[model samples]
Target chain A: MSEVLTYITEHAVQWGAVILLMLGLYIVMTRGNLIKKVIGLNIFQTAVFLLYISIGYVLDGAAPIVLEGAERYSNPLPHVLILTAIVVSVATTSLALALIVRIQEAYGSIEEDEILEHGET
Target chain B: MERLHVIVLVILLIALAVTLVRLRSLLAIAILTGVYSLIMAVVYTLLDAVDVAFTEAVVGAGITLTLMLAAISLTTRRETKPGKRKGQRIVGAATAIVAGVALIYATTDMPGLGIQDAPIHRHVAPYYIETGPTETGVPNIVTASLASYRGFDTLGEVTVIFTAGISVMALLWRWGKDDR
Candidate 1:
């Protein structure tokens, strides 16, 4: 039991990421609501972020700063990428929401099926 | 390794499954999806992708969710209830299974997680690791990759975003209330 616990502790980050990814995907796939889908998308993206960062992690590594006598360090590339990604995500989401608002103004409801049927008429 | 963390993960999975299975309200689902993103951000932090996690937390859990919610506000939420659709589920399931299989096959040769000797470390990473220290003087490898080696890709992405914005503006201007 102790050994298993140790394993789990050692691999906690990995496990957390996998579980989050699965959850996000499930939400994106199964949820019927548009907002929910967006939420799921966010979740999915977060999982990917986790995956990338987790890859950069090094046990017993120092910060990715070069020093006179420092040994190994964790990679900093993923962090930079993630920052840019965050900005992009924010811009896209805001744009999407604006479009959605226009759509809502033109239509009466926010449900996907109702909008489709309405469009047919 | 505490039992609590494992239990929490299992519970999160189950909640996600139920959200997928039982929910009928699209808005509810979207909101839940945001929750899911927040959880994933936490996971990303655990995975040591601190930058990725930060992005995810802000964009995925925050901005993306807001945008999706706005989109839903403009459209219908629920899918049309099934009346005579039969094979849709089968198709979906088949596709999912196939995708899963493909993914598993792809990962079979993946370098073991966190192994420094992986090809990623040897062939791809070393160049960035070496040049970045003295040349660019930037501590962030990601910055080096984007701004130097893959600068063209970054320019392309920026162009795409610009084009998208312009397109949206054109569409809106052409279809505004005054025109109608």
Candidate 2:
């Protein structure tokens, strides 16, 4: 049972991440709403983040700290990189959202097809 | 206990698939996308990547959702209808088949998950794990790798971020008439 538990604990995150990524892709592909597509993009990026972080985990590992004489520690590099990623993501999202606002102003509607139609006219 | 987690994962995956397949509204799709990110964050926590998970939760879930919603406010809710074309369907199907085949082929020779003796383990990973103690004095292997051995990669990542910001500003900034 413990072995089973271990296996589940280890593999669960990957499976979940894959599912989320697939779902996000589906939204991006199928959704007509520009905003919804952006949301899907966020989902996709999140799935990647989960994948990287999951790779960093070590069972029973201590926090990445250099104590007097520690034997094992959880990897911290993924964490640092992730922190940077968060900032980047925020900046990108805000910029994208701002563009959307401008797009709305230029065209009466936000629908992708409608915008194209408006442009054509 | 392990089976329970696996079951939950399966359920989540199923829900995700259903959402992808059936949803018609673009706005609903975006919200579902945010939920997917949140689920991914949970997956990261389970994997023990606490730091990465925290970042994902914030950037993916919080910030992303807000931005998408703002986009929605600016745009219409409806998605465009697909044009009638049998050729398009055939092309799409063929492309999807090729992608699936490629993915399967790529995975064929891949190492099993978490195998201690995988090539990645033998390569730079071991070097970092072994020398990290003396070189960076950092306990976290991931941190040491990013901040030290792979420090260059981190720098590159930062550069990318800077570029992205500049591009966004350049694209979004408005010209003023007061200047001249």
Candidate 3:
């Protein structure tokens, strides 16, 4: 019990991130709505960003702005990497939304099951 | 105290996720998703990832929400209720649980919360930290690494963004003949 408490206290943020990740996955898996799935995907992506940023964190560290006498800074590599990733995610979301629009126009329905049924009939 | 804040924000984020999944109204989902992104941006800021937080605020909260709303306007606001498939839902739940457990197991191997001597901090990070300011003359190590040391990668990313923009325009553009 003591060990468990120690672990939780040390890694609370990471555990929270993991829970968020699972929630996103659950949303993606259960929802039948196309737009909802996209939103789930966004959530999933954000959770990943959280995990990465958490990994790069340093206790009592400053942001990666190099001041004259700054001693410790959080890992800037992850920040740079996440910047590119964030932009890519936005691009992906835009493309996915555009495709959703086209799907609606093509089948007159945005539900995944409805689109499948329309194809069958 | 900061950890407590992170916990609270994460809990709120989970609540928002639950709400998003329960709500079938597309407009509400879009709006909630925007709020979710904003919260995520705040979380990023709290983690000392200000650059990422700024980008998330602009692109994730702002542009993505606009695009989702535009898509919603083009389609029905309510999702059609499909016949419930209990088997699929069960399978999905099982998969998510298994994946989540595996991820948690992996986290056990990760370097503990904020140890400066972690493997990630030991690699190219040290090199960048030591020389980035001198080589690039930029105070922000992230900007220096992103724009100078990794110029080619940034260029490639910019190209990808440009291509995505062009592709979206092409996909949505209506021909003059169709308009008439």
Candidate 4:
């Protein structure tokens, strides 16, 4: 109905976040390429950051600068949290990439199933 | 309206995700990931989290993308098909659907975007917004909260970054000889 469409349109950002999260999950679960898995994880992490940032938005608010005439501001806590999270995400990406490199060196491949087969033999 | 722009960006994000599913080239996927992060950063700015948008642009789009490119170079850019697992795709889709449904259900009662009465706007955020400048002498509430009120947490975050640096160095650095 029109009412449902209106609500969906209003919270489009939140819905976007959820759908992206699911896409990330699907990529991680189904992708066999190790680098692809990492990409999926990064997408998943970024979607979460979006979810938090969207929560902090305020109506007719400016940036969280405590200046005169800026009567209202969005939440700053999520910004702080996600700032740290972004660094952590890159850290995770780096570590995972290094591991992927090592796997490639050891097993001569980066595919999950190939690595598993190498382990069995 | 401004909301229209956000809708367009969200649509672009979904379109990129679907393309990622179809793309087999690792380098192409990595580049698309960077584009995705950059668009996500713009969306953050529109939502008023400029600090977050800035960091995401740097770390997510910049550093993370570079790292992925390096990783692709070190490994193969060609992605081979998976073994014939009959039900993996179905199971993955089912799992995604279940989790997506749960998240959607949880969101049903959440305050709509930018509503003042939301619980997030009710508690400590008010304290930060009201007293940030006076307490920390920083016009930016995010900087004030990041540096002063939550200084210890920021320190912890720095330590985490430092740890990550150390870890990456340890893992990737060749030390003296080329092991590979």
Candidate 5:
């Protein structure tokens, strides 16, 4: 039992990220709201970031910096990639929102079904 | 870096993600997403990725929330209940669950959390950690790697952001009359 708990503890971050990713998938698949879809995408993106950071963790390691007395550091490559990805995520979110605004302006309704119905006419 | 703390934070992140899915009001979702990202930032810090934590806190929490709220202001504030979407919901849930279980199963092959000599810590990482500061004069290894070693990646990142900016402006800016 204790071993099982330890296993759970060790894998918690990875499994938690998977769950969050699934939730994002569900949201994107089911929600008709475009903004909600974007939020769902954010959740998915954040989960990827979480998984990457978790993978880069080193036991008792210092943050990825050059220090005189530090033994080791967590992998810096993931940190670099994620830093760039996070900024890109914000950019993608803003651009998606901009398109949503245009959709609202053009169709006079943001609901997907309504927009489609208008299109049929 | 108490392991317990990480477990707690991961649980909190899951709870927050679940809450976000349940929310109907876009405004409330926007605010809660900020809170969620802030907590996620704390989790990143505990995992020894300070640069990532800082970026997540700032861009994920601050800038993303602002853009979400701005978009909400321009569009509807509340999500209209999607009509006859029951079949879609069931299919989505099924797919998500199946994929999630598969992903968790795949985790068995992953190195356990925080093993010092994990494969990821080998190869280029050791080279970067050992020689980055001396070569680039940047104390932060992440910065050195991003700005110096992986110059093309940073360049591509800039291009993505620039394209996104121009596209957003083109979509939202009023060029002629009858613009909303």
Candidate 6:
């Protein structure tokens, strides 16, 4: 019990993030709804963002602002990387949504199974 | 105290994710996704990635949500029932579990939270920290590195975003012939 507690205390955030990633994947894999799948993708992407930023954390560190006297700053590289990632994600989401709109217009349904059934018929 | 806060937020995020999965209403899902993004932005802020948090807030919560809602308005709001057979679901679950376990196992090799000597920190990070302000004359190291040290990468990212915008417009733009 004590060991379990120690592990949880040590790695709770990371484990939480990992669980979120799994949940996102589960949704993406199981859901027939295209929109839900997109939401899952967003969740998965954000989980990765969480993991990257968390790795850059420094104990007792201030934000990565350059100051004359401040000594410790959290690693800014991951933050920079994630900034670009966020914009890319938004672009992807918009493109995906636009595609979904077109899909709906073309197939009259956004559910994967429905679209497939229509194709079969 | 901070760890506790992070843990709490993580739990909340999990709860939101579960709810998002269970809910079948697309409108509700869209709103929940926005809320999830907002919470993620807060989490990023707590992790001292303020710039990331800002972008997540704008893109994740703001623009993405609006676009999703627009798409939802154009499509049906109710998701059909799970269409996959039991075997498919089982396979998917197995794959997700294997991947998750692999990722967790991989984390064992990673340096613990905030070790100053972590490999990631030992690399170009130190150089950026030491020279970023002087070289770029920017107080924010992230700004300096993103705009100066990695200018080409930023330019490429901008180009990608612009291409996406143009593609979306081209895909959606219809001639006025239908109305006429």
lDDT of 3 by residue, B61-180 (tens): 899989998999998899877587788788878988898899889888887767788999888888888899999999899999999998999998998889889988888888665642
Tell me the spans in candidate 4 whose CA falls farther than 4 Å from its real position.
Answer: A1-5, B178-180
Q: Write the per-residue lDDT of candidate 5 for residues B54-117, one digit (tens) a residue.
A: 9989888999999999999999999987788899999999999999999999998888889888
Per-residue lDDT for A1-121 in model 5, tens only? 9989878878888999999999999999999989999999999999999999999999889999877899988999889888998999998999999999999999988888999999999
Report lDDT per candidate.
Answer: 0.58, 0.62, 0.86, 0.88, 0.91, 0.87
Candidate 3 residue lDDT tens string, A1-114: 988875775577777778778878987888888988889888888888888998898877888988777788899999998999999888888888888888988999888888
Estimate, for each residue in B1-180, the C-alpha lDDT of model 4 and write its tens digit. Answer: 556677789889989988888799999999999999999999998989999999989988999889889888999998997779659999999999999999988888888778877899998889888888888889998998888988998888888878878987888778899654
Instruction: Highest lDDT: give the candidate number.
Output: 5
TM-score, candidate 3, first chain: 0.92
lDDT of 6 by residue, B40-148 (tens): 8888888888888888898889998899889999888888777546887787689889999999998877776666778888887888888899888999999998999
- Per-residue lDDT of model 4, residues A1-121, tens digit only: 9888768766888888999999999999998899999988887888899889889888788999876788888889999899888887887788899889988887999998888898999
Scanning candidate 5 chain B in windows of ten residues, the lowest lDDT window is: B171-180
DockQ of 2: 0.33
Docking class of 2: acceptable
Query: Every prediction's TM-score for the first chain?
Result: 0.80, 0.86, 0.92, 0.92, 0.96, 0.92
Question: What digit string (tens of lDDT, one per residue) describes model 1 on residues B53-89?
Answer: 6666776677666666656655667754544334544
lDDT for A95 (candidate 1): 57
TM-score, each model? 0.69, 0.71, 0.95, 0.96, 0.97, 0.95
Number of the predicted model whose TM-score against the real structure is largest: 5
Deviation from native of the Cα of residue B68 in model 2, angstroms: 1.7
Better of 2 and 5 by TM-score: 5
DockQ of each: 0.31, 0.33, 0.77, 0.83, 0.89, 0.79
Once fitted onto the true fold, the runs of candidate 3 whose alpha carbons sit more than 4 angstroms away are A1-6
**Of the pair 1 and 3, which is ahead by DockQ?**
3
Residue B139, candidate 1: alpha-carbon lDDT:
65
